[model samples]
Target: MKSAHQRFAGRYRPPSPKRSPLITPEGAAALKKELENLWRNQRPVITQAVSEAAALGDRSENAEYIYGKKMLREIDSRILYLQRRLDLIKVVDGLPADPNKVYFGAWVTLIDDDDNERHYRIVGADELNPSAGCISIDSPLALALIGKQLDDRVELNDLDRGYDIIAINYVNATST
Candidate 1:
Protein backbone atom coordinates (compact mmCIF):
# COMPACT_ATOMS: atom_id res chain seq x y z
CA MET A 1 0.00 0.00 0.00
CA LYS A 2 1.11 3.59 -0.63
CA SER A 3 2.10 5.76 2.30
CA ALA A 4 -0.38 8.27 3.74
CA HIS A 5 1.57 11.24 2.34
CA GLN A 6 1.69 9.59 -1.10
CA ARG A 7 -2.06 8.99 -1.01
CA PHE A 8 -2.58 12.66 -0.10
CA ALA A 9 0.11 14.02 -2.38
CA GLY A 10 -2.17 16.65 -3.83
CA ARG A 11 -2.94 18.11 -0.45
CA TYR A 12 0.60 17.84 0.94
CA ARG A 13 2.96 20.71 0.36
CA PRO A 14 6.70 20.58 0.58
CA PRO A 15 8.39 22.70 3.20
CA SER A 16 9.98 25.92 2.06
CA PRO A 17 13.72 26.13 1.69
CA LYS A 18 15.54 27.01 4.87
CA ARG A 19 16.83 30.57 5.21
CA SER A 20 20.51 31.39 5.66
CA PRO A 21 21.60 31.20 9.27
CA LEU A 22 24.06 34.06 8.92
CA ILE A 23 23.24 37.36 10.60
CA THR A 24 25.11 40.66 10.66
CA PRO A 25 26.44 41.81 14.03
CA GLU A 26 24.04 44.74 14.07
CA GLY A 27 21.12 42.48 13.32
CA ALA A 28 22.07 40.14 16.12
CA ALA A 29 22.37 43.06 18.51
CA ALA A 30 18.96 44.38 17.52
CA LEU A 31 17.36 40.98 18.09
CA LYS A 32 18.99 40.76 21.47
CA LYS A 33 17.77 44.21 22.46
CA GLU A 34 14.25 43.45 21.31
CA LEU A 35 14.16 40.19 23.22
CA GLU A 36 15.38 41.94 26.34
CA ASN A 37 12.85 44.72 26.01
CA LEU A 38 9.95 42.36 25.46
CA TRP A 39 10.93 40.08 28.32
CA ARG A 40 11.98 42.61 30.95
CA ASN A 41 10.14 45.77 30.06
CA GLN A 42 6.98 44.96 28.14
CA ARG A 43 6.13 41.63 29.67
CA PRO A 44 6.21 42.98 33.23
CA VAL A 45 3.88 45.84 32.46
CA ILE A 46 1.44 43.56 30.70
CA THR A 47 1.63 41.09 33.51
CA GLN A 48 0.83 43.81 35.99
CA ALA A 49 -2.14 44.89 33.93
CA VAL A 50 -3.36 41.34 33.69
CA SER A 51 -3.03 40.99 37.44
CA GLU A 52 -5.03 44.18 38.03
CA ALA A 53 -7.68 43.04 35.58
CA ALA A 54 -7.92 39.65 37.20
CA ALA A 55 -8.46 41.25 40.61
CA LEU A 56 -11.53 42.99 39.16
CA GLY A 57 -13.12 39.49 38.93
CA ASP A 58 -15.20 37.93 36.12
CA ARG A 59 -12.27 37.46 33.74
CA SER A 60 -14.64 35.83 31.20
CA GLU A 61 -16.24 39.26 30.62
CA ASN A 62 -13.11 41.38 31.19
CA ALA A 63 -11.78 42.89 27.99
CA GLU A 64 -8.65 44.25 29.61
CA TYR A 65 -7.84 40.86 31.06
CA ILE A 66 -8.38 39.10 27.74
CA TYR A 67 -6.30 41.61 25.83
CA GLY A 68 -3.52 41.52 28.40
CA LYS A 69 -3.42 37.72 28.30
CA LYS A 70 -3.22 37.71 24.54
CA MET A 71 -0.41 40.27 24.62
CA LEU A 72 1.46 38.23 27.21
CA ARG A 73 1.23 35.09 25.04
CA GLU A 74 2.52 36.99 22.04
CA ILE A 75 5.40 38.44 24.02
CA ASP A 76 6.34 35.02 25.35
CA SER A 77 6.18 33.52 21.88
CA ARG A 78 8.44 36.21 20.47
CA ILE A 79 10.87 35.82 23.36
CA LEU A 80 11.10 32.09 22.69
CA TYR A 81 11.59 32.60 18.97
CA LEU A 82 14.29 35.21 19.51
CA GLN A 83 16.15 32.98 21.97
CA ARG A 84 16.09 30.07 19.56
CA ARG A 85 17.10 32.17 16.56
CA LEU A 86 19.90 33.87 18.47
CA ASP A 87 21.31 30.51 19.45
CA LEU A 88 21.06 29.13 15.92
CA ILE A 89 22.28 32.10 13.89
CA LYS A 90 25.95 32.86 13.32
CA VAL A 91 26.87 36.51 13.69
CA VAL A 92 29.06 37.89 10.89
CA ASP A 93 31.04 40.73 12.44
CA GLY A 94 33.92 41.59 10.12
CA LEU A 95 34.18 42.53 6.50
CA PRO A 96 34.68 39.89 3.84
CA ALA A 97 38.27 39.21 2.74
CA ASP A 98 37.49 40.60 -0.70
CA PRO A 99 35.97 44.05 -0.27
CA ASN A 100 35.88 44.45 -4.03
CA LYS A 101 33.13 41.86 -4.39
CA VAL A 102 29.58 41.91 -3.08
CA TYR A 103 28.97 39.85 0.07
CA PHE A 104 26.87 39.69 3.15
CA GLY A 105 26.65 42.85 5.27
CA ALA A 106 27.90 44.98 2.36
CA TRP A 107 26.08 48.15 1.46
CA VAL A 108 25.79 48.03 -2.32
CA THR A 109 24.88 50.83 -4.70
CA LEU A 110 23.29 49.94 -8.00
CA ILE A 111 22.31 51.93 -11.06
CA ASP A 112 19.33 50.45 -12.81
CA ASP A 113 18.49 50.50 -16.53
CA ASP A 114 16.61 53.75 -16.04
CA ASP A 115 19.67 55.43 -14.47
CA ASN A 116 17.90 55.44 -11.11
CA GLU A 117 20.19 54.72 -8.17
CA ARG A 118 19.27 52.17 -5.54
CA HIS A 119 21.13 51.25 -2.40
CA TYR A 120 20.65 47.96 -0.58
CA ARG A 121 22.39 46.28 2.29
CA ILE A 122 22.53 42.50 2.05
CA VAL A 123 21.61 41.18 5.47
CA GLY A 124 20.10 38.14 7.16
CA ALA A 125 16.50 37.21 6.46
CA ASP A 126 15.43 38.06 10.01
CA GLU A 127 16.61 41.64 9.64
CA LEU A 128 15.29 42.48 6.20
CA ASN A 129 13.48 45.85 6.10
CA PRO A 130 12.55 46.73 2.52
CA SER A 131 11.68 50.33 3.39
CA ALA A 132 15.22 50.77 4.70
CA GLY A 133 16.74 49.07 1.66
CA CYS A 134 17.98 46.10 3.60
CA ILE A 135 17.51 42.95 1.56
CA SER A 136 17.81 39.40 2.80
CA ILE A 137 20.84 37.48 1.60
CA ASP A 138 18.59 34.66 0.48
CA SER A 139 16.60 37.07 -1.70
CA PRO A 140 16.90 36.77 -5.47
CA LEU A 141 18.48 40.21 -5.86
CA ALA A 142 21.05 39.62 -3.17
CA LEU A 143 21.79 36.13 -4.44
CA ALA A 144 22.49 37.54 -7.89
CA LEU A 145 24.65 40.33 -6.49
CA ILE A 146 26.81 37.99 -4.43
CA GLY A 147 30.36 37.58 -5.74
CA LYS A 148 29.79 40.37 -8.27
CA GLN A 149 32.38 43.14 -8.62
CA LEU A 150 32.17 46.86 -9.06
CA ASP A 151 30.88 48.09 -12.44
CA ASP A 152 29.56 44.62 -13.20
CA ARG A 153 26.09 44.32 -14.65
CA VAL A 154 23.53 42.04 -12.98
CA GLU A 155 20.72 40.76 -15.13
CA LEU A 156 17.88 39.59 -12.98
CA ASN A 157 16.15 36.59 -14.53
CA ASP A 158 12.84 37.21 -12.76
CA LEU A 159 12.70 40.97 -13.22
CA ASP A 160 12.66 42.86 -16.50
CA ARG A 161 15.31 45.34 -15.32
CA GLY A 162 19.06 45.02 -15.00
CA TYR A 163 21.41 46.85 -12.64
CA ASP A 164 25.05 47.84 -12.57
CA ILE A 165 27.07 47.70 -9.40
CA ILE A 166 28.37 51.20 -8.97
CA ALA A 167 29.67 50.90 -5.40
CA ILE A 168 30.16 48.33 -2.70
CA ASN A 169 31.25 49.12 0.85
CA TYR A 170 31.42 47.08 4.02
CA VAL A 171 30.63 50.07 6.19
CA ASN A 172 27.35 51.93 6.17
CA ALA A 173 27.93 55.35 4.64
CA THR A 174 24.78 56.78 6.23
CA SER A 175 25.88 55.64 9.68
CA THR A 176 28.89 57.92 9.54
Candidate 2:
Protein backbone atom coordinates (compact mmCIF):
# COMPACT_ATOMS: atom_id res chain seq x y z
CA MET A 1 0.00 0.00 0.00
CA LYS A 2 3.01 2.30 0.16
CA SER A 3 3.37 5.01 -2.49
CA ALA A 4 6.27 4.92 -4.95
CA HIS A 5 7.79 8.12 -3.59
CA GLN A 6 7.47 6.87 -0.04
CA ARG A 7 9.42 3.70 -0.85
CA PHE A 8 12.05 5.55 -2.87
CA ALA A 9 12.30 8.41 -0.42
CA GLY A 10 13.80 6.16 2.21
CA ARG A 11 16.16 4.45 -0.25
CA TYR A 12 17.68 7.31 -2.29
CA ARG A 13 19.69 9.25 0.27
CA PRO A 14 23.32 9.79 -0.55
CA PRO A 15 25.95 7.74 1.19
CA SER A 16 27.59 9.37 4.18
CA PRO A 17 31.08 10.77 3.76
CA LYS A 18 33.89 8.49 4.95
CA ARG A 19 35.32 9.26 8.37
CA SER A 20 39.05 9.50 9.08
CA PRO A 21 40.80 6.35 10.29
CA LEU A 22 42.68 8.01 13.15
CA ILE A 23 41.80 7.90 16.81
CA THR A 24 43.43 9.07 20.01
CA PRO A 25 44.39 6.57 22.65
CA GLU A 26 41.70 7.90 24.97
CA GLY A 27 39.12 7.68 22.26
CA ALA A 28 40.07 4.09 21.56
CA ALA A 29 39.73 3.27 25.23
CA ALA A 30 36.29 4.86 25.39
CA LEU A 31 35.11 2.87 22.38
CA LYS A 32 36.39 -0.35 23.87
CA LYS A 33 34.56 0.40 27.12
CA GLU A 34 31.33 1.06 25.25
CA LEU A 35 31.64 -2.21 23.32
CA GLU A 36 32.25 -4.15 26.48
CA ASN A 37 29.31 -2.56 28.25
CA LEU A 38 26.99 -3.28 25.35
CA TRP A 39 28.09 -6.88 25.07
CA ARG A 40 28.32 -7.72 28.74
CA ASN A 41 25.58 -5.67 30.35
CA GLN A 42 23.08 -4.27 27.84
CA ARG A 43 22.64 -7.12 25.37
CA PRO A 44 21.78 -9.70 27.99
CA VAL A 45 19.22 -7.49 29.68
CA ILE A 46 17.50 -6.65 26.38
CA THR A 47 17.49 -10.30 25.33
CA GLN A 48 15.81 -11.26 28.56
CA ALA A 49 13.22 -8.55 28.15
CA VAL A 50 12.46 -9.68 24.63
CA SER A 51 12.11 -13.30 25.73
CA GLU A 52 9.73 -12.32 28.53
CA ALA A 53 7.66 -10.19 26.21
CA ALA A 54 7.47 -12.97 23.63
CA ALA A 55 6.29 -15.39 26.30
CA LEU A 56 3.27 -13.15 26.86
CA GLY A 57 1.89 -14.45 23.50
CA ASP A 58 0.87 -12.78 20.23
CA ARG A 59 4.14 -11.01 19.42
CA SER A 60 2.48 -9.35 16.39
CA GLU A 61 0.49 -7.09 18.73
CA ASN A 62 2.95 -6.95 21.66
CA ALA A 63 4.39 -3.49 22.16
CA GLU A 64 7.03 -4.61 24.62
CA TYR A 65 8.29 -7.31 22.27
CA ILE A 66 8.43 -4.89 19.34
CA TYR A 67 10.22 -2.23 21.35
CA GLY A 68 12.69 -4.74 22.76
CA LYS A 69 13.45 -6.10 19.32
CA LYS A 70 14.10 -2.56 18.02
CA MET A 71 16.35 -1.77 20.95
CA LEU A 72 18.29 -4.98 20.42
CA ARG A 73 18.80 -4.13 16.76
CA GLU A 74 20.10 -0.68 17.64
CA ILE A 75 22.53 -2.06 20.18
CA ASP A 76 23.76 -4.71 17.77
CA SER A 77 24.30 -2.08 15.07
CA ARG A 78 26.31 0.14 17.41
CA ILE A 79 28.36 -2.80 18.66
CA LEU A 80 29.21 -3.84 15.11
CA TYR A 81 30.18 -0.29 14.14
CA LEU A 82 32.40 0.06 17.22
CA GLN A 83 34.05 -3.26 16.57
CA ARG A 84 34.77 -2.44 12.94
CA ARG A 85 35.90 1.11 13.63
CA LEU A 86 38.17 0.07 16.49
CA ASP A 87 39.91 -2.48 14.30
CA LEU A 88 40.52 0.00 11.48
CA ILE A 89 41.52 3.01 13.58
CA LYS A 90 45.15 3.83 14.15
CA VAL A 91 45.61 5.27 17.62
CA VAL A 92 47.90 8.28 17.90
CA ASP A 93 49.55 7.73 21.26
CA GLY A 94 52.72 9.83 21.09
CA LEU A 95 53.74 13.43 20.75
CA PRO A 96 54.35 15.06 17.42
CA ALA A 97 57.93 14.99 16.07
CA ASP A 98 58.08 18.76 16.26
CA PRO A 99 56.39 20.19 19.33
CA ASN A 100 56.90 23.75 18.11
CA LYS A 101 54.59 23.33 15.14
CA VAL A 102 50.94 22.35 14.88
CA TYR A 103 50.28 18.61 14.45
CA PHE A 104 47.95 15.92 15.58
CA GLY A 105 47.49 15.96 19.36
CA ALA A 106 48.91 19.50 19.61
CA TRP A 107 47.25 22.15 21.72
CA VAL A 108 47.31 25.31 19.66
CA THR A 109 46.63 28.91 20.61
CA LEU A 110 45.54 31.39 17.98
CA ILE A 111 45.28 35.18 18.14
CA ASP A 112 42.70 36.86 15.99
CA ASP A 113 42.55 40.37 14.51
CA ASP A 114 40.97 41.79 17.65
CA ASP A 115 43.66 40.18 19.83
CA ASN A 116 41.15 37.60 20.97
CA GLU A 117 42.85 34.35 21.82
CA ARG A 118 41.39 30.90 21.12
CA HIS A 119 42.72 27.61 22.37
CA TYR A 120 42.11 24.33 20.57
CA ARG A 121 43.57 20.87 20.32
CA ILE A 122 43.90 19.11 17.01
CA VAL A 123 42.69 15.58 17.61
CA GLY A 124 41.49 12.61 15.61
CA ALA A 125 37.95 12.60 14.26
CA ASP A 126 36.89 10.07 16.88
CA GLU A 127 38.11 12.32 19.68
CA LEU A 128 36.90 15.67 18.40
CA ASN A 129 34.72 17.33 20.98
CA PRO A 130 34.00 20.98 20.26
CA SER A 131 32.71 21.77 23.75
CA ALA A 132 36.10 20.63 25.06
CA GLY A 133 38.04 22.66 22.48
CA CYS A 134 39.04 19.62 20.42
CA ILE A 135 39.15 20.03 16.66
CA SER A 136 39.27 17.17 14.21
CA ILE A 137 42.52 16.84 12.27
CA ASP A 138 40.48 16.92 9.06
CA SER A 139 38.94 20.30 9.90
CA PRO A 140 39.86 23.28 7.80
CA LEU A 141 41.47 25.15 10.67
CA ALA A 142 43.49 22.15 11.78
CA LEU A 143 44.43 21.36 8.20
CA ALA A 144 45.72 24.88 7.74
CA LEU A 145 47.56 24.89 11.05
CA ILE A 146 49.35 21.57 10.62
CA GLY A 147 53.09 21.81 9.79
CA LYS A 148 52.93 25.56 10.54
CA GLN A 149 55.34 26.99 13.09
CA LEU A 150 54.61 29.43 15.85
CA ASP A 151 53.70 33.00 14.75
CA ASP A 152 52.53 31.69 11.38
CA ARG A 153 49.33 33.03 9.83
CA VAL A 154 46.60 30.46 9.11
CA GLU A 155 44.17 31.04 6.27
CA LEU A 156 41.01 29.05 6.93
CA ASN A 157 39.10 28.56 3.70
CA ASP A 158 37.92 31.90 2.25
CA LEU A 159 37.68 33.81 5.51
CA ASP A 160 38.85 37.39 5.17
CA ARG A 161 40.63 37.21 8.51
CA GLY A 162 43.61 35.05 9.44
CA TYR A 163 44.65 33.76 12.82
CA ASP A 164 48.21 33.92 14.05
CA ILE A 165 49.55 30.85 15.80
CA ILE A 166 50.69 31.94 19.25
CA ALA A 167 51.68 28.72 20.95
CA ILE A 168 51.84 24.98 20.40
CA ASN A 169 52.28 22.18 22.94
CA TYR A 170 51.87 18.41 22.92
CA VAL A 171 50.49 16.63 25.92
CA ASN A 172 51.22 13.01 26.71
CA ALA A 173 48.65 10.67 25.15
CA THR A 174 48.10 8.79 28.38
CA SER A 175 47.19 11.98 30.22
CA THR A 176 44.52 12.83 27.67
Candidate 3:
Protein backbone atom coordinates (compact mmCIF):
# COMPACT_ATOMS: atom_id res chain seq x y z
CA MET A 1 0.00 0.00 0.00
CA LYS A 2 1.21 3.47 -0.83
CA SER A 3 1.89 5.70 2.13
CA ALA A 4 -0.64 8.49 2.68
CA HIS A 5 2.10 11.06 2.12
CA GLN A 6 2.99 9.43 -1.20
CA ARG A 7 -0.56 9.77 -2.42
CA PHE A 8 -1.16 13.34 -1.26
CA ALA A 9 2.20 15.06 -0.99
CA GLY A 10 4.62 16.73 -3.43
CA ARG A 11 4.33 19.38 -6.12
CA TYR A 12 1.03 19.01 -7.90
CA ARG A 13 0.96 19.58 -11.60
CA PRO A 14 -2.39 20.85 -12.77
CA PRO A 15 -3.87 18.89 -15.64
CA SER A 16 -2.44 19.95 -18.99
CA PRO A 17 -5.75 20.50 -20.74
CA LYS A 18 -6.02 23.89 -22.38
CA ARG A 19 -7.74 26.15 -19.89
CA SER A 20 -10.27 27.79 -22.17
CA PRO A 21 -12.40 30.48 -20.69
CA LEU A 22 -14.66 29.72 -23.60
CA ILE A 23 -16.74 26.58 -23.97
CA THR A 24 -20.15 25.84 -25.31
CA PRO A 25 -22.68 26.07 -22.51
CA GLU A 26 -23.71 22.55 -23.44
CA GLY A 27 -20.25 21.21 -22.62
CA ALA A 28 -20.26 22.78 -19.18
CA ALA A 29 -23.69 21.39 -18.40
CA ALA A 30 -22.64 17.95 -19.54
CA LEU A 31 -19.62 17.95 -17.21
CA LYS A 32 -21.76 19.06 -14.32
CA LYS A 33 -24.27 16.31 -15.03
CA GLU A 34 -21.55 13.66 -15.14
CA LEU A 35 -20.15 14.84 -11.80
CA GLU A 36 -23.61 14.73 -10.28
CA ASN A 37 -24.43 11.26 -11.61
CA LEU A 38 -21.14 9.79 -10.40
CA TRP A 39 -21.62 11.15 -6.91
CA ARG A 40 -25.32 10.30 -6.62
CA ASN A 41 -26.13 7.21 -8.67
CA GLN A 42 -22.85 5.37 -9.14
CA ARG A 43 -21.48 6.08 -5.67
CA PRO A 44 -24.42 4.55 -3.82
CA VAL A 45 -24.75 1.63 -6.20
CA ILE A 46 -21.15 0.57 -5.67
CA THR A 47 -21.33 1.10 -1.92
CA GLN A 48 -24.46 -1.04 -1.68
CA ALA A 49 -22.82 -3.75 -3.74
CA VAL A 50 -19.79 -3.76 -1.42
CA SER A 51 -22.03 -3.86 1.68
CA GLU A 52 -23.97 -6.83 0.40
CA ALA A 53 -20.79 -8.67 -0.50
CA ALA A 54 -19.17 -7.95 2.87
CA ALA A 55 -22.24 -9.38 4.58
CA LEU A 56 -21.20 -12.74 3.10
CA GLY A 57 -18.46 -12.84 5.79
CA ASP A 58 -14.83 -13.98 5.57
CA ARG A 59 -13.75 -10.94 3.58
CA SER A 60 -10.26 -12.42 3.16
CA GLU A 61 -11.76 -15.13 1.00
CA ASN A 62 -14.56 -12.99 -0.42
CA ALA A 63 -13.81 -12.27 -4.06
CA GLU A 64 -16.91 -10.17 -4.46
CA TYR A 65 -16.06 -7.99 -1.50
CA ILE A 66 -12.48 -7.41 -2.58
CA TYR A 67 -13.43 -6.62 -6.17
CA GLY A 68 -16.36 -4.49 -5.08
CA LYS A 69 -14.16 -2.44 -2.78
CA LYS A 70 -11.59 -1.99 -5.51
CA MET A 71 -14.23 -0.84 -7.95
CA LEU A 72 -15.80 1.51 -5.44
CA ARG A 73 -12.41 3.03 -4.69
CA GLU A 74 -11.80 3.48 -8.39
CA ILE A 75 -15.13 5.24 -8.79
CA ASP A 76 -14.42 7.52 -5.86
CA SER A 77 -11.01 8.35 -7.31
CA ARG A 78 -12.60 9.29 -10.60
CA ILE A 79 -15.10 11.45 -8.79
CA LEU A 80 -12.32 13.31 -7.06
CA TYR A 81 -10.53 13.76 -10.37
CA LEU A 82 -13.63 15.16 -12.02
CA GLN A 83 -14.30 17.50 -9.15
CA ARG A 84 -10.80 18.93 -9.32
CA ARG A 85 -11.01 19.27 -13.10
CA LEU A 86 -14.38 21.01 -12.97
CA ASP A 87 -13.06 23.45 -10.44
CA LEU A 88 -10.00 24.43 -12.53
CA ILE A 89 -11.90 24.54 -15.80
CA LYS A 90 -12.95 27.84 -17.26
CA VAL A 91 -15.93 26.75 -19.26
CA VAL A 92 -16.37 28.61 -22.49
CA ASP A 93 -20.08 29.32 -22.42
CA GLY A 94 -20.17 30.58 -26.00
CA LEU A 95 -18.21 30.69 -29.22
CA PRO A 96 -15.36 33.12 -29.41
CA ALA A 97 -15.54 36.11 -31.74
CA ASP A 98 -12.66 34.74 -33.78
CA PRO A 99 -14.06 31.49 -35.03
CA ASN A 100 -11.78 31.35 -38.03
CA LYS A 101 -8.74 30.57 -35.90
CA VAL A 102 -7.91 27.29 -34.25
CA TYR A 103 -8.19 27.49 -30.48
CA PHE A 104 -9.40 25.45 -27.59
CA GLY A 105 -12.78 23.77 -28.26
CA ALA A 106 -12.36 24.21 -32.03
CA TRP A 107 -12.92 21.05 -34.02
CA VAL A 108 -10.29 20.78 -36.71
CA THR A 109 -10.31 18.47 -39.69
CA LEU A 110 -7.02 17.70 -41.40
CA ILE A 111 -6.51 15.97 -44.71
CA ASP A 112 -3.26 14.51 -45.91
CA ASP A 113 -1.94 14.64 -49.45
CA ASP A 114 -3.43 11.18 -49.98
CA ASP A 115 -6.80 12.69 -49.07
CA ASN A 116 -6.98 10.66 -45.85
CA GLU A 117 -8.92 12.75 -43.32
CA ARG A 118 -8.88 12.91 -39.55
CA HIS A 119 -10.67 15.23 -37.16
CA TYR A 120 -9.52 16.41 -33.75
CA ARG A 121 -10.56 18.87 -31.13
CA ILE A 122 -7.91 20.64 -29.04
CA VAL A 123 -8.92 20.41 -25.42
CA GLY A 124 -7.41 19.86 -21.99
CA ALA A 125 -5.22 16.83 -21.41
CA ASP A 126 -7.77 15.49 -18.94
CA GLU A 127 -10.33 15.44 -21.73
CA LEU A 128 -8.02 13.80 -24.24
CA ASN A 129 -10.07 10.84 -25.37
CA PRO A 130 -8.99 9.90 -28.88
CA SER A 131 -12.12 7.82 -29.36
CA ALA A 132 -14.14 10.88 -28.47
CA GLY A 133 -12.17 12.92 -31.07
CA CYS A 134 -10.59 15.15 -28.43
CA ILE A 135 -6.85 15.75 -28.48
CA SER A 136 -4.70 17.59 -26.01
CA ILE A 137 -3.64 21.07 -27.05
CA ASP A 138 -0.16 20.18 -25.80
CA SER A 139 0.12 17.39 -28.38
CA PRO A 140 2.33 17.46 -31.45
CA LEU A 141 -0.50 17.34 -33.98
CA ALA A 142 -2.39 20.20 -32.42
CA LEU A 143 0.87 22.15 -32.16
CA ALA A 144 1.36 21.70 -35.87
CA LEU A 145 -2.20 22.70 -36.69
CA ILE A 146 -2.55 25.71 -34.45
CA GLY A 147 -2.78 29.10 -36.25
CA LYS A 148 -2.96 27.39 -39.64
CA GLN A 149 -5.78 28.62 -41.87
CA LEU A 150 -7.53 27.31 -44.98
CA ASP A 151 -5.19 26.23 -47.75
CA ASP A 152 -2.19 26.79 -45.47
CA ARG A 153 -0.61 23.39 -45.42
CA VAL A 154 1.47 21.97 -42.58
CA GLU A 155 4.30 19.52 -43.13
CA LEU A 156 5.07 17.38 -40.10
CA ASN A 157 8.20 15.29 -40.03
CA ASP A 158 7.46 12.14 -38.07
CA LEU A 159 11.13 11.73 -37.16
CA ASP A 160 10.91 8.18 -35.86
CA ARG A 161 8.97 7.00 -38.92
CA GLY A 162 11.18 8.98 -41.31
CA TYR A 163 8.14 10.27 -43.16
CA ASP A 164 6.43 13.61 -43.50
CA ILE A 165 2.69 14.19 -43.64
CA ILE A 166 1.50 17.08 -45.75
CA ALA A 167 -1.70 18.65 -44.54
CA ILE A 168 -3.86 19.51 -47.52
CA ASN A 169 -7.12 20.47 -45.90
CA TYR A 170 -7.97 22.56 -42.88
CA VAL A 171 -11.38 23.30 -41.42
CA ASN A 172 -11.80 25.64 -38.52
CA ALA A 173 -14.29 25.06 -35.74
CA THR A 174 -17.05 27.29 -37.09
CA SER A 175 -17.06 25.63 -40.50
CA THR A 176 -17.20 22.15 -39.04
Top candidate when judged by lDDT against the true structure: 1
Stretches of model 2 off by over 4 angstroms after superposition: 1-6, 172-176
Worst lDDT 10-window in candidate 3: 161-170
How far does residue 12 in candidate 2 sit from its true spot (Å)?
2.4
TM-score of 3: 0.69
Model 3 Cα lDDT, one tens digit per residue, 35-143: 8998999989989999999999999999999999999989889889778767776665445566666666677667666677776777765566899677877777777
Model 1 per-residue lDDT tens digits across residues 47-97: 999999999999999999999999999999999999999999999888889
Candidate 1 has a TM-score of 0.88
All candidates' lDDT scores? 0.94, 0.88, 0.69
> In model 1, which runs have C-alpha deviations exceeding 4 angstroms?
1-16
Displacement of the residue 115 alpha carbon in candidate 1, Å: 0.8
- For candidate 1, give the lDDT of residue 168: 95
TM-scores, all models, native as reference: 0.88, 0.88, 0.69
Candidate 3: C-alpha lDDT: 0.69
